[model samples]
Target: MKPYKNKINRIRSFALALIFIGFVVMYFGIFFKQYPLVMVIFMVLGLLCIIASTVVYFWIGMLSTKAVQVVCPNCGKATKMLGRVDMCGHCREPLTLDPELEGKEFDESYNRKKPAQSGE
Candidate 1:
């Protein structure tokens, strides 16, 4: 089975990674101190990454407001879920808001809009 994580947690992880990457990029810039232009370029790129991460963090706050808060049946813990299918943040148990999807295998594709069926 594919590894599944809570939507919010996944996005948060991405943001954290971006911050780490930004620091790493900036650290690399120190190595190019001999060349002022190259060092400046690296610093700018690093700053952009940090800025992007801040934007993503803000976006997460917006998404959190839209996420549904529910008690996980498997873990018995309150968790926020986004989209049609999400996993429990604590236990990684698959969750769904749609009755039709219950008992079916967990698939992230279910969150995507389906193409219209053509009449054969």
Candidate 2:
């Protein structure tokens, strides 16, 4: 079985990872102390990563406001959900707002817009 996580949580994790990567990159810059230009470049790149992470965090905040808050049937905890299918943050229970999708296997692709199909 595929391990699934709340969409918001996944994005948040990505943002957190970016921050760590930024710090790691900056730490490497310290090793190039003998070459001023190279050290400067590394520092700049690291700063950029941090900035990008900050942007991603801000985006997550915006998405949070748009997501639906519902109590998970399995976990009995309030969880935020986005798109057609989402998992409970607390228990990893699959959730969906669409009645048609109820009882069906969870598929993330359902959230994406599908192109019109022509008759075969």
Candidate 2 lDDT over 29-101, as tens digits, reads 9999999999999999999999999999999999999999999999899999999899999999999999998
lDDT of 2: 0.93
Question: Candidate 1 — which residues are off by over 4 angstroms?
Answer: 115-120
Q: How much lDDT does each candidate structure score?
A: 0.93, 0.93
In angstroms, the error of model 1 at 88 is 0.4
lDDT tens digits, residue span 1-120, model 1: 889899999999999999999999998999999999999999999999999999999999899998999999987999999989999999999999999999998888889899335483
